[model samples]
Target: MTLRIATAGKGGVGKTTFTAMMTRALVEKGARPALVVDADPNANLNYYLGVKYDATVSDLRESLKRDQPPSGMSKPDFTALKISEILSENDGYDLLAMGRPEGPGCYCFVNEVLRAAMTRLASKYAVLLVDNEAGLEHLSRRTTDDVDNLFIVSDSSIVALRAAARIKLLSASLELKVKNISLVLNRIKSDAEREAAISSARDIVGKDTQIAAVIPEIAEIGGMLSSGSNVFLLKDFPREILEPLVSPHET
Candidate 1:
């Protein structure tokens, strides 16, 4: 069984950065052939992972309306083949971008086909890491339904904590089959700010949700990102901060 992990938060909350770092850490720890899905419409995880993708799932969905499979090929098989073609294979993982959001139309057939294809593809990997948008659109669509760990990231701010809290509430309403949910406070500058964020998060996300990690504001990481360097190149990245989130059995 594949270990499914997902990161969710509002825009500019560093969820994407966290996802990238976690991917590098997983790869370093011998978690090979992981499938990293960039579910964000903005789709910049490729840059963070130092990989490039030609097409996105959205492009394929759009093409399905106009393109047909070969005379003897089934639509599902063709869709799966296209998905494979778009995958950006890297040293230890494959990247799949969700691309832009769906346009004005009913995508029932296209969505079902993509979902089935994703499931088939994910089974070949040991882990599946998804970088989700603020709205949790992919989860709502049931594209990646059974998540093992859902990390809600938030910066050290009241507003960000509130947004994280709302995400926790939304996840409950969606009834996602998530085994564990944790709050990852990112870019915390001081202990006071961390305490405040934790307090706010507890009130907003409830006491049941644990505060899994609080990553400090590391200037090296910022510099590396600004230089368009991949997360793997960062020196002394606080990967131990993510250890609590990954189960021992899964690793």
Candidate 2:
């Protein structure tokens, strides 16, 4: 079975960073070259993974919508070819980006083609990690139909926590086939802050979900990211927060 792990959090809460680190950790644990989906429009997962991508799903969407198919090729066929070409292979994972649509026209067709293509592409991998947008509009749209583990990451700030809560609530309301939902507090500086976030989470994120892990802020990793250095080269990563996630399910 393909284990699908999707992340949700407000922008700047280290969601993308966490996703990249988690991918690196998983690869270290022998889940190398897993399919990584950069669903966020901002599209910086490539930088963290230290690879360059030729195109994005959004680029395909615009191209498909704007230009006509060549000769006898159908839209789906042409899209499949383009998507196959855009898959960037790197050391520990492959990157697929979802770019923003260019035109003001409706994107229903674009979404259909992209979602189907993603679903088809996912079948080849053992694990799929998606770095989603802050609001998680993709969940509501069902781009990823079934999620084995949905991680809601947040910073220590109450505003970030509240955004995490909203994501939890919004995802529950949608008809999403989510198997498990958990919270992750990123960039924790002290025990007191961790305790406070855990305390607030019980009320804000509801009873069913739990604060699965608290990641301490690491200056070394921060410096690497700030300098646009490849995280995979860093010998130390937050395994405390990522190891549990690499396995199939947490007990």
- Predicted structure 2, TM vs. truth: 0.89
lDDT of 1 by residue, 1-251 (tens): 87888888878989888999888888888877789988777788988877789988888776876899989998777887888888899989999887765565454654564466447778898888888877656666776567788888898777777777877877788887877788899998889988887887887778886888999887877777579787888886887887555553732
- The local distance difference test score of each candidate is 0.79, 0.79
RMSD of each: 2.4, 2.5
For candidate 2, what's the RMSD? 2.5
TM-scores, in order shown? Answer: 0.89, 0.89
lDDT of 2 by residue, 135-188 (tens): 766767776557788888998888888888888888778867888888889898
Q: Residue 134 lDDT in model 2?
A: 80
Q: Over 4 Å off in model 2, which ranges?
A: 62-77, 103-110
